[model samples]
Target: MALFDRYLAGQLLVYFGFFSLVLVAVYWVNRAISLFDSLIAGGSSVITFLEFTALALPNVIYAVLPVSALVATLYGINRLSSDSEMVVAQTTGLSPWRLARPVLAFGLVVALMVSVLGHVLVPLSRTALAERGAELSRDVTARFLKEGEFLHPGRGVTVYVREITPQGELLGLFLQDRRNAAMRTSYTAERAILVRVDGTTRLVMFDGMAQTLQVEDRSLVTTTFQDFAYDLAGLAGGDDGARRRDPREMPTPALLRADAETQAVTRKDVAKLRSEGNVRFSEALFALGLPLLALGFLMLGGYSRFGLWRQILGAVVAAILLKMLANVTETAARDDAALWWTVYIPAILTLALGFALVWRDTRGPHLIRPRGDGAPA
Candidate 1:
């Protein structure tokens, strides 16, 4: 039995790894293209792009674990059945429940992995990702240093640079600020550098001429200087620090214990926080029950020489429906925390169905003993 369990468990894990890696790669490529476009368009460095994608992995892994677990179970069992290995084991008095133990254990392992990702790693990564995004969006040096291109960091603000030196010097810098609408200002500089002052970014231009035009008075004033300071902080929303974390980025404990003040700070009501907390647990349980559900369906009838394709299709459909129900329940829970109990419906229902299948298999069909070697009982 131990050997039997080991064989099945090993097969499941191998299949799970293969499916998970492939699925993650597909998802990663999809996200990477979008992230790459955004980061490159914003003039961010390659290192920053890598960092953002790395931080996004936990969430992706969390999304795919349950589906991977189900596929692994189905593929592993179907292969074993097709090869007659499962039939051999059954002939040795191994009941369906006994054979399913290994699968259940495999599901538990997947559930643990998902729980960690959902409750801890994902939140931390999300927090870091958001902070990094805010930091990048505020980097005026990156925004303004593109050579020979007109860059618009904000509405009514246009910046141009003729050349960027290896020493981080900007040459032939041109900036036009018409954001005030009542007044227009233009600055042309021979050279410029970005300097930080009191947590604000300022472009210190050398040998620059500033021209101002008054809209109402229709008057123009021009000034030439050896050094001038133009505040660049306004280009980045004037915020020097991280933005407030979203409710999904809050740790489970913090979210669960959040008070009215915390809610105000996070801008998430108690219902939202409670729903997130419930979602974490429900997701884990859903991962755990998926294998049970799949196996129970596969075990519906004894092995057929051709295949159990029908049972496999039935299992897939059932899993999809269960997932849909779970999503709907989660949505309802988010609207009203009192509906939180509903989030567990998928797990509970699937587990019950699995158990019922096992019981019916255990009982089998009761056959009456032949009476007096006749057809009549």
Candidate 2:
């Protein structure tokens, strides 16, 4: 019986890995293309794109685990039944409770994996991604150092560089700023340099002349200077890192704190941060219950040549409905942190219903008699 439990557990784990790989590959392709476009469009290198995508993978894998667990459970149950293994095991007088032990153990293992991701890898990766993005935003050389082409960093700004030397010097720089409707300004410089000051980007032009025209009064003013600083903070490709820290990117411990410091740093309310924190723990429950539910629903039916197609479809629907319930509960919790316990309702309900299904199917005339003079007990 111990060997039997090992076999079932091993088979499910193997299939879970297989399905997770396949699904992740499919998801990766789709995400990679979009991310590639976004990074490249932002003037990032191929290496940068790969790094960003890799950092994004933890979130993807976290979302995939639950679905993988469900598919693995249904497929394992179907295979065991189709191959007559389930029949053999039942004929040996194994109670449903006995069979459920291994399934429950496997579910707990899967749940632990989910908890690790939710608590550890996800927050770490998200923080790294955000930090990298902030660095990219301040990297003005990479963003606008393209020579011999006119570039528009914003609606009313135009930049042109004749050449970019190996020493990071920009020659023959031309900049036009017409953002103010009443006036237009043009700058021509012999050279320009990119500088960073307190997480803000600035372009300092050397030996340049500024021409300003007043649109309403048709007046012009000109100024020549040795060096001038132009702020590039709110322009295109700006850093959102300076904006505010997102509660999602914060560690679960910080979010769980929901203190004044955390709230100030994230610029979010206590309810929102607490909800995010609680959701992380609640995800484990879904991971543990979904597989059990899938197995129990499929086990409700006896063997047939046609297979358990109906039971399979029913399990899929149940999973979807449970997911919807989870969403509803999440929304309610988000509105008020006091309702944090609502997040567990879907999982608890799933586990209870799953037990009921498995117990009902393993009872009555369909089940074979046990070996030890068990008076139909």
Cα lDDT tens digits, model 1, 2-102, are 99998899999999999999999999999999998877666677898999999999999999999999999999999988888988998899988898899
Worst 10 residues of 2 by lDDT: 364-373
For model 1, state the Cα shift of residue 271 in Å. 0.4
Q: List the residue pairs that clash in candidate 1.
A: none
Span of 10 residues, lowest total lDDT, candidate 1: 365-374
Best by TM-score: 2
Q: Write the per-residue lDDT of candidate 2 for residues 246-331, one digit (tens) a residue.
A: 88788898888899989888899888898888888888888898888887777764555678887899889999999999999989
The C-alpha local distance difference test score for the whole of candidate 2 amounts to 0.85
Deviation of model 2 at 189, angstroms = 6.1
The regions of model 1 sitting more than 4 angstroms off are 149-159, 165-169, 174-193, 204-231, 240-242, 363-377
